[model samples]
Target: MANVSYFEAWGMWFDGRSTPGNDLLGLSMIWWGRFGKILSFVAGAAVIVDLLGPSRLSRYSDRLTGFLARRTFMATAGASFVAAITFLWITDPIGMHRLLQSVLCLTFVTAAGLLVTAVSRALPATHRVIRAASRERVVG
Candidate 1:
């Protein structure tokens, strides 16, 4: 087995071939590599959410944001595992693999965007306030 980065793992998965070997909970290289890609997105999203402000969907507590993030992440992880295994085992591996990969990539991008929005909301808005302070100091 060659050392592959997370991005390279996606290449291995979508190369229109499945390799032999199990690195992820007994899943073969194809499924494992795909799983790695999904899991990385899920984990990275969770971390970003954890570092961000409270969710608008919840009021008065950060716990709600954390809870929802955990639930959503777990749900994605579970669904990805089931879908990957189902497609790899019971259906056409190549077609299903591509489909699942696309779905996961879409989900990852959406989650990252949401995380960015949340964190941006927590950032201190300095443009107007700083400009006003500078004007006052200059005038005085």
Candidate 2:
């Protein structure tokens, strides 16, 4: 569980050098590759914000546990592990290693997303309970 900047962490983990200009395959890759870069850049920017902008790891952890709960974590973790393993000893792997790394990087995003959802589920219930406990003002 190493904490890292979104871009650096994901980029290294899945160092698939993207060749943006290679139209060898067809038109499909060009569109996909461009968007992939956009997504990667945005994710990296978000990671930087999460780290450098007055946010704490403890805060992030709470969010992770609550939102990222059992199901989402398990699902993403499973995907990540499977993707990571797919890179092993593959020949002419179609740059699949990088793709797998990208997939693994998404697992963390899934974790964070789950954490957020968990928090949303908790706040409403807690808020309702608190509201119910409040009494009418009885000014003497």
Indicate which candidate wins on lDDT.
1
Worst 10 residues of 1 by lDDT: 53-62
Task: List clashing residue pairs in candidate 2.
Answer: 67-114, 67-115, 67-118, 68-114, 68-115
Evaluate all candidate structures by whole-model CA lDDT and list the values in order: 0.54, 0.52
lDDT of 2 by residue, 1-140 (tens): 23334464346548875434333234434565688899999999889855653324334544545554555656555554554454343422545566665665566556555655565567556544433433221221
> All predictions: root-mean-square deviation over Cα?
15.8, 16.8
- Model 2, which residues run further than 4 Å from truth? 1-100, 136-140
